[model samples]
Target: MVGRGTILGVLGVLMAACGTPQRQDSGSESVEGRVIRPAGLAFPYVKRPACPGEGCAYGTWLACDTVSVYAREADTTERAFYLAREEPFQVLAGAVHVTRPEVVVVTRPTHQIGFQESGVLFQQGDTLFVLDYIAEGFFDAWYRDSIIETEIFWPWEHWYPAKDYEYGGDVVQQGVASFWIQVRNGSGQEGWVPADRASLASANSLDPDPPRCPARAE
Candidate 1:
């Protein structure tokens, strides 16, 4: 439960919640489960849509059986933040705790989960309109309906087009292309395997996306 306070003051209230359940782990923060709703904040609107069938366009929100957990402040360059399962957090001044990792745990009046690590937290806010940004940006720049099939008829001449494009003139562009290739391949394969193929097995198991997502609904 996010602790009670005004929207502007909730930020400071979170800091106080840090030391509430005073535990003495050298690196662990305090966790006091004080629940409070933000003043004038609207109640959460919960929606659960069925999984898409054969040709239905995938909805922006996906379902999750377990609470979704992520590294706090993923946009930041620092990598020191990570949250634990059942970790308590505040959203719109209400406190909600994740019961399991990687599942979608719905908390209202915010109707979303916040991954808190150290002093920072990360979650989708309706105000960001990030999905619109992604869709627009993807279609505007990255999306290509037509397949770009480049036949390497002259592999000998352009086997390493990237090098030629960047440093063929004189300076060496360094060998980060290998890193990028690895990243691209890794990202494409980053999904859960079917339970039959994996060590765990369950029918109601969740995918990587959050369940009952309220962020992209606007």
Candidate 2:
């Protein structure tokens, strides 16, 4: 018979080796000779509706928050956008864009620990956009509630308090994809755009030389 201690030890080792379980769709891939995994941000404590019918004991529930992570080719500066599974790094280059290339700064948020530290910067005409770096990860939080109610006893009614806080939100899986960029257009309007929509600026020049239009054949 296997001992309880032995089983726990083995489980601990397995968890340590696996680190965090990644999403099923997110498999490991190789990029520039380095192994990359899918990763994303995870939000916890989102309110959700409870199940319907008499079987449903809990009133309301919480939902899980899942986000995708993406990456792009490294630029001339050897900087690239990656997930926050590991340590933070700097990305010196931005992706190519239709408009003039602009210098963008990528930095990890100080609040996000144990995650990547890279972001993208875009400059379109006089408008500049910044995408603050956030690590791709998730966590599970448990919440509970206690209720007081009247119970039927032998020839009498009794008051009792019940506890029912054993519900766990949702499982968080690890994955990677491009982060979203916050855009502030020339008109001062702000919006969120996916990282893939615009390429990072390779050069810092506000008005880089534009690609010449092709000449039509006579």
Candidate 3:
């Protein structure tokens, strides 16, 4: 039998429950993260995902799912920087693993199923929050939304876009986006990494070990 707690994307559940996306305030650091990716290769930070050719300030290499940030000024020089392999960096801006209570809400009513849901509920303090969600019934994909506002974009003109970026699902498929986290090391050097390249370190994690997520409201 399907569990009653089945959960799933951006909706009222997102606004109603998880009000306002978590973000680092101007000049105020919030969540902490680390970059240890590109795997065997040392992590690469680009001046901008704008590598038009080997002529770019950082030289041609800004391809794949890379992340970027708005330079306080428009200085495009010094585009790329390679960090020490497997070093810890601070997430200037990124998602934090938060602990909160979750509940299921039916968003769409169907003939076969009682309802369809796009998000799950969670609580912070006395307020509620929601995380985007999906199931395998009518939708093959989950998480629908735009990253244009979040500075996460895919298919930089410099590099080849992902072959499967189109992704399936008409209504169910969220708009395409590539996520990269803005990070800074101890030397105050800041760079961007594809979401996959970074890892959350305990030194500055928002949540403690064995995250105590809030319980579902009965």
Candidate 4:
């Protein structure tokens, strides 16, 4: 029979191998890279301390305080997992479960696959603020209440073409019906054209003033 310790060791190895992650670009510059000091911050910025003692068990975590670790799940749920300053943990799957309020989790093997460094894992319970960079492709924002607000881009136009012709139509005389006017692509972009300036010939352009001529005898 396999011992519990052996099973745990094998599981840990498997997790370490498969759970390794690539540098996930959250599209946020701050979270996209390595952990660095927030500029203009004071010294001795009390980080959630690492596990001071050895042999700390999993789920042994710190309190919720400053930043936090959250996952946008497949079901579209944002769950927060409280973490300690020093526990190293990688996000495998599922919603985060937190006992303490403001704890961060540190990961092992530093920057390898399945290894995540100290992730800020505490929530302030304040109004969650999110900045969406539309240019950068953030179309939606997720809230703790599980409400997702999405933004869509729509452009407006002043004029639209009524018709479309595959090839330019035959050139017609200035006043001829077949002149510059031709059907355009229905789905094409809109552009404006002056009715009067459609053709250089007198026929195409409607005369501003009417010439009153007597009717010819039939």
How should the candidates be ordered by TM-score, best one leading? 3, 2, 1, 4
Could you tell me the C-alpha RMSD of candidate 4 in Å?
34.3
User: Distance from true position, residue 176, model 2, in Å?
Assistant: 2.7
The TM-score of candidate 3 is 0.26
Each model's Cα RMSD: 23.8, 26.6, 20.4, 34.3
- At residue 147, candidate 2 shows an lDDT of 11
Candidate 3 lDDT for residue 78: 45
lDDT for residue 162 in candidate 2, whole number 0-100 = 40
Predicted structure with the largest lDDT when compared to the true one: 3
Question: What is the clash count for each candidate, in the order shown?
Answer: 14, 20, 18, 28
Model 2 / residue 24 / CA error / Å: 13
lDDT of 1 at 23: 17
Q: In TM-score terms, which candidate is top?
A: 3
Cα lDDT tens digits, model 3, 1-218, are 11111110111121223222232122221222321111111112122232111111121122212234333222334455654433445655432111211111122321122124343222211111112222122211111221111111111122234676531111111112222345575677776554422222212122233212233359
What is the C-alpha lDDT profile of model 4 across 28-110, one tens digit per residue? 21221323111222222211211111121222112212223333321214434433333223211111111111111222212
Scanning candidate 1 in windows of ten residues, the lowest lDDT window is 175-184
**Model 4 Cα shift for residue 102 (angstroms):** 26
Against the reference, the lDDT scores of all candidates come to 0.17, 0.20, 0.25, 0.19
In angstroms, the error of model 2 at 137 is 19
